[model samples]
Target: MIYSFKILQRYQLSKVILVVLLLIVLVVGAVPGYITGKWSWKNTPRITNFKDLRQIREEGLTISDLPTISHQKIRIADHNWLLQKVKQDNQSVILLLLTPNGPKDKPQVEWMDINGFNRWKTDSHQRVKFTVKIAGNGNGTTDSEKQSSNIEARFFRGWTNQQTYAVMQWYAWPGGGSPETGDWFWKDRSAMISKKRVPWVAVNILLPVEPLADIDPYLPQVKSIGEKIQASLMKEAFK
Candidate 1:
């Protein structure tokens, strides 16, 4: 009887230890998520409307006046993005939003190949050629610099009819779980693995500044406004 009692005591002790270890493992695993998740929406910006965008920088163009929107259908391959051409006076901006449901069958998750403007994409159109870089498309830019907005507000400088146009684009995403800027590949790849629906917006703009030998002068305005818009929309999105 004593031998049987000893065996039972040992069995109970082992079972208790296993349960304690399991609890410790669960808490250990969940701690990081719990601590970091608290600030998920911390740095994200709020969502803004067209009016808010124009207000960011008016430049005496009277852009506040209701602008005209052209509902044009633009495609980036099997993915069909919602396209809008907003024109105010002599200034214009194109907005593209990638949605799961569009003219084409919905992709498991939507992705925008903003690489269409890269000069290598076409053989013709020699005179109006445009080159674009989005940081993580295997371009030499370091991951630290490509972390945000740089990929979104990609630079473009090209001439047509002896006039140069300076342009850029930015991708907008909500706060929580929003991929850091320029982390295009990692975010999408992770989404594909986890089967998470990726949501984002792209803003393309033709700056109102006069183009010169180089378009670097207009870059700051585009970047500042782009960041403002992102902050406005992202905070709202997460809210």
Candidate 2:
């Protein structure tokens, strides 16, 4: 009777091992599919529908008449990335930020409600701007002296119906001649375009804001911004 019991126990142990092996194989096979699905989804331009609208509301963008939201994801490296053309007032705003691992994996909010953004501010007269002096690494954790430098410089938010057009001129011509900045706009863009554009270095100088630790801590906020911008775009597109 004892011998019979030992045989039964050995058989059950083998069955358990076999089950474990199968689970491992299943997980391994599923991994590729999971990665592919994510890649495909990220590559696709955002599509808004009723379901997506509901999600936008949950993120804190008040949708009284529904807002239009459109986004295209740009993956810079295996890790870092950015999202473009996220707007809330159906206005075009280019949000540039770090997309590190963990919570920072999502795009950091750089600019919102952007009436227009320029590589270089033109003419002290036309530009409505603000500058903050930043010295240390922009991580807000630094002493008040360092953190106080977080600055948002802009010329104008709404001067006419052509906000993005003026901004795009800066983006495209970059260093193109401008009567305001005394043609410094073209000089700056020319220099930036000439150099083998350094990753993140160029933008860091333009914004000069510090990193906010890991992204996870700020993901909810990021999602909320994305959704609102998306909803605003959707409302316009649907109209």
TM-score of every model versus the real structure: 0.40, 0.21
Local lDDT at 210 for model 1? 52
Measured with C-alpha atoms, the lDDT of residue 232 in candidate 2 is 34
Q: Give the backbone clash total of model 2.
A: 22
Which ten contiguous residues of candidate 1 have the minimum total lDDT? 122-131
lDDT of 1 by residue, 169-226 (tens): 5444443222234454335334433333334544455454353446666566555544
Let me know the TM-score candidate 1 reaches against the reference structure: 0.40
Model 2 over residues 1-239: C-alpha lDDT tens digits?
99999999999999999999766755554455466684322232222233432333233233333342543434443433233344444544444323223311222233331213333332222321222223334456445533121112222212332221122111111111111332333233333323211111012111111232232333333334433333332332221
